[model samples]
Target: MHQPTKPTNPIEKYFSVINLYHYYFFFILFLSKVPVFWHFLSLIFLSPPMDFYCNNTLLIAANESHKNFCPCEDPWWDKSLFTETVQTKFDLYCDKKWIVSFTQSVLYTGTLIGSIFFGILSDKYGRRFACTAAVALLAISGCSLSLMPNITSFIIMRCIEGISAGGYIVAGFVFVVEHCGPNNREIVSALYHVPFNLGHISLAGVSYLLRNCDHFQIAISIPVAVFVTIRCLTMESPKWLMDQGQTEKAAVVMEKISKFNRKPHGSFKEEIEEYTAKRSVRSGHMHFIEIFKHRRLLLNLCCMSAIYFVCGIGFYGVSQYIGQMSRDIHKNIAISGILLVPASISAIFLLKILCRRTLLMITTFLSGVFMITVVFIPAHLTLLRVIFACICDCFFFMAFITAFLFGVELFPTSVRSSALGFLSLMSRFGQIVAPPLNSLPEFVTGLTFGILAICGAALCYPLPETKNIDLPSSLEDTKTLNKKNTLGDLEKPMDGQSTDIDKPDTSKKT
Candidate 1:
């Protein structure tokens, strides 16, 4: 699409150029999400908890004869799918199975911590530094998993990996969104997760081919390493730079983007200076806690955080349960990834016409309905259950995307990173609680997601709609969103006057 001519808004006039350069960089940033999926979901294939039997011949024979549990001293995990894994290597069957879920929880916890830490780092230093540090740490922590001598070390490394992943998500997303014009940010935000789905699809193939846990771990880390090495070529967000009063750096970056897009620079440097001059000077750096000081901001953050939490539970929990449903985990994951495409594609059009709050409510409520539907299906209908679960997942995915976009628009640029980080922390907490749900009965699991989805939908009602609105640049700008009935007030009839519509239609033959 071409940039609008003679755009009045300064942000629009400068960064609205959507051309090959913009597309190219967006794709590059999107590629960064690929490794995130690989590392995040690799555990399913790496240490699949398949059923196993005793390796002892006598115990096996006795169990076969008795048709009961074997009294074998040592258990031999099923290696038909994965040749080597934490489960097989550590004999994590029977009593030790709890460790597997605990490991995943640890990972989520790390991400929870990382969200706040990196949020502050991103806001304080810069998006470029946060992104670079996150990726670099991701490579180190991911590759280190293979060399870990024990499960404890492995879990520790997983936590670190989780931190980097969370940091990358917050920093990277804020960076990309800040670069786009207001008109384009919605589509950009909606489509950003497409690469993540691609990463899931590729993870299935990579894990299917590499079977061994260490090999798979190392394989995924390779891409992260490459990304880290080349990340120096990446640039900081000009909006962020300008917001921080670094106009010269913002000018240079804007110049580069303009040149690459083949658009005239058009005194963007002067515009930046003028914009900064008019902006109110901040008394101090903003904090996530400041959100609590504003009633509307706090309410929005709480409501959005609730939605994000439910999205987390549904997204991560459903995926885990489904990954175990079929014999072919690869096919299951690949199909899951494939399903994400239509949700994202549908969102592009749906988001344009629908209010952000409306879309979130509808999607979340539908997700709950589908999840509850799964509880009614008979146990014998595995295929039917899988189909319904996939549908629920798709709806939740849509809600998840909407939550991100809505949350970004709800807050101002100054505290955007921290606010998003806290929201993500809530999401990670939901994920942390999700792994344990897999151990519950199928109906219980389904019911949990259903209840949470309904609550999430209810929470959406309190949030302000953010469709087609410019990103708020400060707390004062965000407060203006509360002025919804300003036009309505002007249209109201005065005490002594009657509006044409309110008056009797004498011209018409009533």
Candidate 2:
């Protein structure tokens, strides 16, 4: 590989030259999180449509209360008539509410598949290409679901959107972290949720504005179109490029990034050369199975996966059912949306102050404690329940956001996406089981959430703290700190051999 010459400008020495454009890059990549916001919104829209189908049955029953045996009145209610229409096909086995839950589960199932397949594919290709392709699929499939003529078609479309969404989320997070410098990485990563919260607000607003099905579909489709347009101009990660041995191309992208920030073109060549020199000796071709070859890496992945799964179930179980919670308290969806702002803001600030491990453990434990009290709160004291739920919501949001950043930090660049993909796969499995669990008795839901929280707390104890630690550049680095209590010792080797347990001088590495 030909190395480009270093820039002569003294001003280019600092990495901050590219900081100005960081937010712009962040926003474009973070826009992908909108699908998560849409997933929640879709649940809101989806349930009602199913209700419209099944609610008719309830109305029919109410009208025929006095009759000895009430016959089906309308063709829509007739078993045979239902068999002919789109709604009738799924109406036979389940009520609309169950159908909604089933479809959402189907979406998660597609996500599980997509995360594994495209997560690996993103590594093989480039992050930008893989993510952009996922966005295109999202726009097409999401729009198609809105226009679906029948129940069968709607289910299929939801599955397609889910699969694409799975790929997009994994790729988006990897792309953002790869571009960020070490000090600012956690903050930038947490900002991923800000747009998602805005999207949730948009969903609530849209639902309130267009309560009817037709208008709701149009409202959701608009953002999908916007995402596709934004992704077209998005840049590939320079880190990923360097990993693939394309240092010159990485430098060109860095130069463009400097230009985009309205800063003078800095020494991209110098930075690339420096970064390449530090590249881990480990090759990029390491398979997924190798993630476990090192015990510490294996333990780290397990802990992260368990935390992710519990958080996924608890978070989605509570969040997806918020509409029901709102109705239970006689509040509107807009109020629910407004209430989410605090949690999102708290997440942004909390991530900055706390290390990834401590923050996640504390929040997860607290959220579970709060949830156990939810059912016991008196119905007459509506204010107490709402306040308690809001607190729980805050913890849930904080824990969820922390896990995402924590998971990214745990893996080396070699299998970063693949490790995340596997974690995502487990999370999807949690999502798959949550809906049915929600149908359990109130006591059961609280108990399950409590168990989830406790599990998350336990998992946090085993994870190596990554606060202020540079991301591991190779598999050897990953193993060096596998059982170490402090990250300080892993910076450099004391002897020529890999075994270096003593603290090294940090000033030397740079």
Candidate 3:
């Protein structure tokens, strides 16, 4: 008769490998952000040129052609031949620029819907399946956009890309956090964006190489293909499987993880069985209302959303306008692209050393300072503008990484994806508003940055620190943390609790 092998403690069996895999997975998912690089490149190519001769020539021509024909000076000039010609040409070149915002809005709308749908589906089906599906969709939509030859097709493809990107981002973050042990969760989450910054840096280089080439479409398509291929080889999150009552499959995944780490395999089935047995009693159906019912969760969500909103405005607004910034500073596209490397490197290091909240507050405040300085730098001082723009990029990237990690840590497992989705939706709202906000007068730029900085600094005071905290495992624990501002009142023994709000403890199970 064959003897049944004993199952090792499931939590301990996979804990170390889980940390390593989380890092590996962070790098893998970072590839998905490559699409944003294409977006960056596309913006750079489309931005108005800053050549001094060309700009002076255009202005001189306008002045000579219509010396006394100011539409503001004489209302009839608005209907005159010259004014009408200029207006028509402007409309032709930038017709429905609002289409960009409208397209983005539709994408966020889809994100709102997909977040709820995928959040539930991920819990039911598993994070691996949902994440893979999201990646496939993102790859297809992103690649399809490269083929667009007209405005309608471009807008449609962009909207579709938004949906896929939104879903992929939410699902990917949730999977990484879920797979990681408490000790490494914050760092893993922060590093999750390294590939994204790398993608941005790579896109800058790729765009510079292909800027004048007619085959720009090919440049965009290549990254999308790479993202899909990489995602196809990735493994499912074992923690997600265990949550869905698939201890047997979870154990198999644990074995694969052990093999990947080249570690000795102990039986993971016993721990899997124990975890599944406990979770099986409670049907894990998360409702939207539950997110708001808990004060701490709600407050955390609000702060996270606000942080993302401000970060989006500062980061994307500055990044998307890099071409303009480059032009104002008289830097070549290649030089501008090269300058982004420092910003990417800064994000990688700063995120590891600083707590998410402190870093966010500091970076955002500094980003505002840089933006205000940019407005005052005389156009003649090209070198000064370049230095300031690079500084802005560094702080912007730092704030972005911090914001991404903050959202991941705030919500519990049950609603992690949903909370991130909602936060992303709000961030997209800022992206939509940023262009108009940026187009405001030079003085307005300083004012806008000042307001955003002040709001972020003030809000940082009340928010709870998440650097060493394990994610809350239950609604009851979440409520206790909210009400008491500490975990002391929770009746459960320390061994039974999965997270400690007061300090970082790696021994706690999730």
* TM per candidate: 0.88, 0.82, 0.75
Pairs of colliding residues, candidate 3:
10-271
In order of TM-score, best first, we have 1, 2, 3
**Candidate 1 residue runs with Cα over 4 Å from true position:** 1-9, 58-72, 281-284, 377-383, 483-510
lDDT for 472 (candidate 2):
56
Which candidate model has the greater TM-score, 2 or 3? Answer: 2
Query: Candidate 1 on 238-322: residue-level lDDT in tens?
Result: 7777777788888888888778777767677888777667665441266678889989899988888888999998988887766
Q: How many residue pairs clash in each candidate?
A: 0, 0, 1
Alpha-carbon deviation at 250 in model 1, angstroms: 1.2
The sequence of per-residue lDDT tens digits that candidate 2 reaches over residues 1-510 is: 222221221212333224766777776677657654576456555444221222355565455442223232232334311112223434433324356556777888889977877788777787888787777888778767667777778888888888888988888788877776545666777777777667766666555556455456556765766676544677777767766677788788878877877776677777667656754464466667888787888999999899889888887777655656544221345566667677777876777677677789999999888887776787788777667767776788778888888888787776788888999998888877787788898778868887788778878987877654455556754654533444344333222223232223232322
Supply the global lDDT for candidate 2.
Answer: 0.68
Which candidate do you rate higher for TM-score, 1 or 2?
Answer: 1
Q: How close is candidate 1 to the true structure, as a TM-score?
A: 0.88
Which of candidates 1 and 3 is the stronger one according to TM-score? Answer: 1
Candidate scoring better on lDDT of 1 and 2: 1
